[model samples]
Target: MFEYQLGIDFAKTLDKNDPLALYRNQFHIPKDDTGNDLIYLCGNSLGLQPKTTKQYVNQELEDWATLGVEGHTEARHPWLPYHEFLTESMAKVVGAKPIEVVVMNTLTANLHFMMVSFYQPTPQRYKILIEADAFPSDKYAVESQLRHHGYDDKEAVILWKARKGEELLRYEDLEQILENHGHEIALIMIGGVNYYTGQYFNLKQITNLGHKYGCKVGFDCAHGAGNVALNLHDSGADFAVWCTYKYLNSGPGSLAGAFVHERHAHSKTLNRFTGWWSHNKQTRFKMRDAFDQLPGAEGWQLSNPPILSMAAIRASLDMFNQVGIEKLIEKSKMLTGYFEFLINALKNEHIKIITPKNQEERGCQLSIQVKTADRSLHEKLTNAGIICDWREPDVIRCAPAPLYNTYQDVYNMVEKLKNILNE
Candidate 1:
């Protein structure tokens, strides 16, 4: 019935021809009870750890064990300036310059830190604008930021909601919100991509609109960092932050990244909560009485970071660098497109995709709105060893990570899903 839809064997042929197929060997794919590979489709949540993560983290562990306090100066990866080792490669991943980016803290902490400098809510412009369906952590962060500035979140925060009966956000509605509240909105902090709908927002368009309205702009890129080309440097956002544990494949609950536009890098007077790492590296160990800050995003650092986490990042960044973001994205487009094709071929009318249909509007993830099916259907998929996630109210997000997922995996997933739905 799907002569053009291609079979599981055809997907295998494509995988054989894939230039990035070799990357699958670099990661440790999860296996099921019988020792079969569990088709992992949750890279949107936590990525598979790179095999080199152990080697990189071991370097730090050995240093801490042997050099102790001296590890800062004597270790293979010096603890004092350890984060510096990752600057170039990490910057490339998000299309940033070395000075524009820094890896530190967790996702929420970095958001709080970025807000300290960028959110600048004033008397006339005290409101914060965010997506109505933002991640719970982000909602809390913005709400608390409003409260911290002596404003009620109920009154001071504006939500850009998805249209009624629609799961996706529209750019036109965003334009309308900006036209209405642009003057009072202090900052436009949005997720570069919506997690639930798998929609990648138009960053440049949003940035332009917010800028035209005299509002500072920022993005929470947790879902966009590795899944899509955030083009953060070119997007003209005032600042952006993301966690590495997601599609970046760093590790679970890993260190996060923060970006500051170059224009604000040297703004020493920009308000921030600082610590020793944020201090000038030259003057940091001087035992000075004054609190001197560093330049660029490094100025946001609060404490000496966990080096082991940095090592895990370095390991993953190396993989990203070797594979190149552009190539990975290219493969992701094809691989995900193939998955979409196969699913659309399903004779069952019960499954519908909630993610945007256009390639430009999404990444690898597809939020399947299982028509008339309950959570038990997802339980069956899980039992069948399809490692996908089911969110509340009936949405299952499946991401075929370019770094490891193959076309055959997509074909197999759809075949099983078809069979189960039929039963």
Candidate 2:
């Protein structure tokens, strides 16, 4: 466990000793009107751009301008198999095999596509299970799927909710829900990391329980991808999906990733929505050839991906490859632990941390529930040049990203919070 200390000097000392400290310079930190750096603690929402992202994107633009249609096969990186460049690195980030991982459609789109194959509902087992506070897009997609299948959304959606007075979800509660209604559930879809509370659920445990009940299980890993070691393959999940714009540091609305367990990689019989890109590459160019599905996760592709957005993803993944997820997570635990310690030091009655205190149970995000606090407080923080995420009602989510955020940044942010609370 990390032993954290108070005072600005301690924060600076930690930053000096941090092996990943130099990485902060690799990102383009946001600046104020006077050009001073803002204390950015919003990686859970959107990660900052890497300095090299521009160069990476420009290369694609240059190739497109020069090669025209020939860029598909003859450009520097070769656009025809562009997504292949990201497979190995992305697989490493999400802890899956190359055959099991693919970078493709947006987060919700991929979720729907995976559902096409995995959420095969029967009259006897037609329910879909998800956390009560699953991300809105996931909830919407699943609800739409149920409606399309002729099931009432309200009747078919099962919520695994937190207790009346508690904020964090318990595994026992999930077990109880499954015990009673597992037979009726055709699919158990959950967030690998709860977006609101930063709770990192045990994916393997959830998958095991769902499979035991004869249900297909998958995860929406939007908040967990680069922030945690997901190990999607080892979890034995049927599938998983995540966006690149968040912790992955890709540009806004960038392409997303999907994972299918290798066991299902070659299942040509699995029902799915396919297009020309999903066909065998060799026969894909043969316009008159019959549809021969490409094996593995690549079979999910609908159309050729945008190479510029992919360039941004490549820039971020290259950094992840150099640093390694293990090292980043090690620093994450320490940085987040230190942030927690400093916040608790305030000893204020109104402030309570809703996110789990256990390093193993949560990521870098700490959801601070300030009693009676309102949007005015959020406005104050913004005016003070602190960029944090303000969820509706009363939560301030701050994530000190391990790649670029420093210990001093955490200290400064807490100091600003303390001053605001004092007022």
Candidate 3:
């Protein structure tokens, strides 16, 4: 257990000794009117921009101006194959193979695309499963897919819910659901990390259970991509999708990523939406040739991507490549553990942390469940210049991202929260 202490000096000491502390300077932390850096504990919503993002994006802009259409094949980072440049780094972030990973459409779009191939339903097996409180977009995408497949969304969607009066989901309940209804379930689509409660599910275990029941499995790793060691390949999931804008330090609404396990890399028989980019690159320019599909996840690309957004992703990923996900995860555990300690020390009756107590079950985010069920607490936090987010109804989510957040940041945030609560 981490022996966390309650003091500004202790927090400073931890920061001084931290190996990843230097990485904080690489990001652009927002400041208040008084010019002090705000305690920006909201990487879960959107990561802070990297210091190099402007330089990376400007290079593409300059190339586009100078070379026009020639930028596609002759720019410093050729636009035609630009997404390929991100494949290796992105694959490493998610523990996927290069062939299994592709940077592509936004999160929900890729989820729908993956479902096109993976969520094949039959007369007997037409149900799709997801978390009860899944992010609204995932729920919408899956419900639409069920309707598109000619099934009643209400009847065909099975939700793995948390037990009554409890905040976290149980694996045993999931096992029972599959035991009783897995035969009818066509696909198991879950969030690799629960967005609201900050629970990181065991992907490998979920995949194993789903496959044992003859169901294909997939995950929306939007919250897990750069924050955890997803190991999507080893998890044996049929597919996964994640956005680059959160915990990735990519710009707002940046392109997302898709992962198709190596097992399906060459599965040409899989039905999918495709375009010119999906055709074999060597023969891509030969426009009238037969459609020879690219061998792997690259086959899912629908169009050539926006280079500026990708440039931001490339800039951020280069930092990830330097620090390595392992070190990030290691620091994440300790930093969040320290935050947990401080929150618990408050002994404030109005507050309760709904996220899991187990370190391995969550990322840096802590879902602070306000007993009052009002936005006042979140407003107070914002007024205090702490940039966390408030989920509807009752929760205030604070994510002390290890990449840029420091021990002192955590300490000050908690101290400020204590002051707010005492008032």
RMSD (Å) per prediction: 1.7, 0.7, 0.8
How well does candidate 3 match the true structure in TM-score terms? 0.99
TM-score order, best first, reads 2, 3, 1
Task: Report the C-alpha lDDT of model 3 over 1-423, residue by residue, as the tens digit.
Answer: 668888899999999999999899988999999999999999999999999999999999999999999999999999999998999999999999999999998999999999999999999999999999999999999999999988999999999999999989999999999999999999999999999999999999999999999999999999999998999999999999999999998988999999999889899799999899899999999999999999889999988898999999999999999999999999999999999999999998988999999888998999998787588888998999999999988999999999999999989999998898888
TM-score of each: 0.98, 0.99, 0.99
| Candidate that scores best on lDDT | 2
Sorted on lDDT, best first, the list reads 2, 3, 1
User: lDDT tens digits, residues 1-423, model 2?
Assistant: 558888999999999999999999999999999999999999998999999999999999999999899999998899999999999999999999999999998999999999999999998999999999999999999999999999999999999999998989999999999999999999999999999999999999999999999999999999999999899999999999999999999988899999999999999889999999999998898889999998999999989999999999999999999999999999999999999999999999999999998888888889999989999999999999899989888999999999999999999999999999998
Which of the two, 1 or 3, has more TM-score?
Answer: 3
Instruction: Tell how far residue 236 is off in model 1, in angstroms.
Output: 0.5
User: Ten consecutive residues with minimal summed lDDT in candidate 3?
Assistant: 369-378
Q: What tens-digit string does per-residue lDDT give for candidate 1 at 233-306? A: 89999999999999998998999999998888889788899999998888888876598778898989999999
User: Which regions of candidate 3 deviate over 4 angstroms?
Assistant: none
For model 1, the stretches where C-alpha displacement exceeds 4 angstroms are 1-4
Which lDDT value does model 2 have at 185? Answer: 98
lDDT, residue 74, candidate 2:
93
lDDT value, residue 297 of candidate 2: 98
